[model samples]
Target: MSNESNLQVTFSKHCNGLFKKASELCTLCGAYIALIVFSPSEKIVISQVPPQNSGPMQFIEANRSAKLRELNAMLTQINDALDIGKKRENELSDLRKKNETQFWWACPIEGMDRVQLQLLKKALLDLKKRIGQHANMVVSQGTPTQTFPFFVGNGSSSNMPIEH
Candidate 1:
């Protein structure tokens, strides 16, 4: 036979022997094994001994599914938070509209009992006191005061300058 043919036979025998030894090692030790061979003619061989019922592809798919489940759970939580935020925003908007439509002082006082009327009077008194205090503060700050001339209600053309 030709020298090239002999070399090819030798190479094939060595590759087989290597694979056999690897298989025996895995069987005896119950260890995982991966082997790769590249031939001079650009041929390739690959072998893997994975666990009994699982392979690399199965593990990857399982991990991918687990991640998907985790992401889905997070998405659900975010959506729920958004829903709650929207509900709170709607409630605030309604409250603002109610406040805009009717001020506290503008509400009907006809239905107020004596206690409610007293509370209202107290609130008004407090408000008046605060207003007076604010006015005094403004005056103390040396803000320029303006005066306006007005005619007295009595049938007389008199210009009375009221300083404010």
Candidate 2:
């Protein structure tokens, strides 16, 4: 099979026949196929399918069932991608939340406006100065410095480019 805008009747018919056989097999014995077709003109086409509920292995029935299986696989992949993206987004959000709890003045500044990022940086700088004084006080009193939280916000304060 080939890609490169397969608008030819013979090519389409062959592709349909291949898919039909694949469908018959899948319906009869729970088998599936992952088909990859490359064209001589520098293009590639990938087709995949999943098991489906089909009637007797006839052309019309098989074609309908095979089409449905293909569509199902396509939709399944889309859904999976969305779910994973959302899950990772949620995980990163949770991590940022936890980091903020530990370092109230420090958090990821992505998706934030310049004003917000600047606010965060200023807040962190002030917190660092305050803690430095607190550290000095603790040292003078000969107490453990471990009790004070460490504020380690990496990168330059010029995180976001300011616009004129």
Best candidate, lDDT-wise? 2
Off by over 4 Å in 2: 1-57, 108-164
Q: Residues 1-164, candidate 2: write the lDDT tens digits.
A: 36446555556677778878877677776667788876445377677866665545455577878999999999999999999999999999999888765543455556555765776777568667877898788889998655544333333343333111
**Considering only N, C-alpha and C atoms within 3 Å, which residue pairs clash in candidate 2?**
none
Prediction-by-prediction clash tally: 0, 0
What is residue 38's positional error in candidate 2, in angstroms?
60
User: Distance (Å) between predicted and true CA of 16, model 1?
Assistant: 13
- The most accurate candidate by TM-score is 1
Cα error of candidate 2 at position 162, Å:
23
lDDT of each: 0.66, 0.67
Q: Which parts of model 1 are misplaced by more than 4 Å?
A: 1-54, 104-164
RMSD of 2: 19.6
